[model samples]
Target: MLAPVTDETLMRRIEQFIHAEARLQDEHAYEAWEQLWTDDAIYWVPANGADIDPKSQMSIIYDNRSRIGIRVKQLLTGKRYTQEPKSNIRHFVTNIEVTGREGDDISVGCNVMVYESSLRGETIWAARTDYTLRDEAGAFRMARKKVALVNNDRPLYTLSFLI
Candidate 1:
């Protein structure tokens, strides 16, 4: 019989997975980042407020798996003006915690601060991100990713990179 994993082991695995995902984004490896998601993934960034319903309220981004693919394609095309130079970005993920778990799904929350520098200028963006990861046979894939920008209620610069 196989031994069951302990909570400490599982949390370590989850943290490592999350850190790898962040590195993929920082490297602008969109294709690899997409692979980190499950087939039925949902990526969302609420506009104006963190608690707003994406279906009823405006959203900075609300993409399903297909839409995420399209977005990746757009970024890879070398045609997006905002991404022409591809802002140099490196985000720090902090306060990572496993909030809940049900069956194969695990919920995680963290705070992120992304520092992006482009021709225009350098900008730092802060946000709280919630993620639901589906554990499939010991592998983890993102099922849902929701980002709530700290200054979402105010005017913001163009967000052309993954958060």
Candidate 2:
């Protein structure tokens, strides 16, 4: 049997994982990022607000595992018009909190600000991201991720880059 993990160790591990994930996105490592998710993953970005039901309300993105794979595949093709020039992006993940844990699954929340720069201009997008991560063979895999963009309630520009 393995030794139990302490809260301090677990928090550090979570922070490291989140930081690495952010780096993958910033570097546009789509394949590596896709491999970090579980088979039953849900990637959601709510449109109206944080509390709206995705099934009943509009969403910026609500992709299941297969759809996630497809999105990554498209990005990898170098044919995605929006990403043709490839925006310079950086993700800042902060205020990470362990919200809950059930069996092998842990729920975490954090505030993220993504800085994106393209030929057109620069934009900073802020959001509170809630994630459900599952421990798979001693490694963490994302099961669900919900991003509540601070400007979701108002008119916005294209979200061509990943948040």
Candidate 3:
């Protein structure tokens, strides 16, 4: 059993994790980004609404660990038309809060605004992301991430990069 950690320490660690994940994506380090997840990880972006079940509804991205690897492979292949030239993206996570905890699992929610620039032009995506991170021997690994895009219900442009 581990001793209770200070709120400041815990928040700092979580902020580091979130910032690192964003950096990995912005730098196009797909392999390193994938390594941030556990084996049973789930990366989901719900369509229509955030609270809907992925299985019974459509999802923008509902990838398992294997599929995540595949997605990265496809992106890195340079065959993805939308990402041929790649997009200059910088997403910042704000208003992050440690919402709850259950044993070794911690739930976090934050607002994210992603600015992307590509051949097609620039686009802004705003969303509220809920993350469930599992404590693995003091290090944290992302177990699940649910992204609720503000414009999910409307048809949007292609997104080759992870949110």
Which candidate leads the pack in lDDT? 1
How many residue pairs clash in each candidate at the backbone level?
0, 0, 0
The regions of model 1 sitting more than 4 angstroms off are: 1-6
All candidates: CA RMSD (Å): 4.1, 3.9, 3.3
lDDT to native, each model: 0.91, 0.91, 0.90
Query: Which lDDT value does model 2 have at 41?
Result: 99
- Could you tell which candidate, 1 or 3, scores higher by lDDT? 1
lDDT of 3 by residue, 1-163 (tens): 4344468988899999999998999988998998889899999998898788999899999999899989999988989998878899999899888888999999988899999999999999999999999999998899998889999999989978988
- Model 2: what TM-score? 0.94
In angstroms, how far off is 24's CA in candidate 2?
A: 0.1
Which pairs clash in model 2?
none
Q: Please, what are the lDDT tens digits per residue for candidate 2 over residues 128-159?
A: 99999999998999999999999999987777
